[model samples]
Target: MRFLLIEDNVQLASAIVERLSLDGHVVDLAPCLADARAHCATAEYDLILLDIMLPDGDGRTFLADHRGRENATPVIVLTARSEVSDRVGVLDLGADDYIVKPFDFSEFEARCRAVLRRKGGASGNRISRGDLKFDTLAGTLQVAGEQIQLRNRELRLFEIFINAPGQIFSKSKLVDRLFSYDEDVSENAIEVYVGRLRKHLSASAANIVTVRGLGYKLEV
Candidate 1:
């Protein structure tokens, strides 16, 4: 999944980006509300990890404005505030969950999964398409009782196709969903990933179908 991390602490953000990237997630870092807003204006994210105290403005205000505009993207507030009232206030402002600072990385990951599952994402970290089994947590595909592993972004691209099934995704859309803003992507990157994914799914009941002049879709 793609995530937008709105935070100011350079070290913490680096840790977060590294952790999430290791799990095959594309993460974009925004040190302030201005950069965060710019990201939101351009790309879509599966989740937003927002810090309440931002360099340019309060994240609570950003959350309020995001909701005021009817953007229902799930947000989990990452802050140092431990007060019950602070949690309630941010929840009232439209945060799906809250995590106090200095949190364990494992616990933080679990919290993110909890929030995403609550928001109808990857149902319990498992998805079954025909005879193909996907374990989101493991980032592996299981078929015929055999586990097939995928590279990071290839798995991400597969996630997109499985989520929408037959919907034809344009190359640009896949690029947006698979690569982060800071990553250097080539013109034919999607084609390369698609080819790689086809090879991985060779033994499975799933198929990645390409529509000439359009894009690609998943068939199971």
Candidate 2:
């Protein structure tokens, strides 16, 4: 899943980004309300991890604006404020969940997984296109009733493609989703994985096709 994290603390932001990335989520971070709002306006995200306090404005104000636009993207408030009124305000303003600061990372991850599951994303962890199916948990692919083994990178690439079938994703976006934020893997690496997956897919390769001037899309 893709997540937008809004927090003014640079260190905490970095840590959260790293941890979420390690859990196979693509995270985009913002340090202020203005930047967060701009990102939310332009990009598609599965969830938003918002901090109530920001340098430019209140997270509640941004939440109100997002709500006024009728945006239904789920939000989880991660903030230092744990007061009852603050919790009520955020939840009533349309946040999906709330996590107070100095919280356990394990709990945070669990809540994230739960929220995503509620969004109907967890069931499709195994991606299917035509006669091909990739079980993300087992890291195994089955084609024409034959099991096909894939390398680590190939599995990651196929996982991303299969999850959002028919959605055109740029090479950069794929790279960001496949690798951790700290990794320096090149854009061309995606092509390499695509080539390998195509070889394994053979005639079924048509399901994963290039979009002119765009990127790649997995046709269901």
Work out the TM-score per prediction. 0.92, 0.70
Over 38-94, each residue of candidate 1 has an lDDT whose tens digit, in order, gives 999999998999998887989999999999999989999998989999999999999
- Model 2: how far is 134 from its true place, Å? 4.9
For model 1, the local distance difference test gives 0.89
Global lDDT of each model? Answer: 0.89, 0.79
Which residue runs does candidate 1 get wrong by more than 4 Å?
none
RMSD of each: 1.7, 4.0
Worst 10 residues of 2 by lDDT: 116-125
lDDT of 2 by residue, 107-195 (tens): 99878766765664656446566788777656689876779877667776776677677899998877766664557899898888888
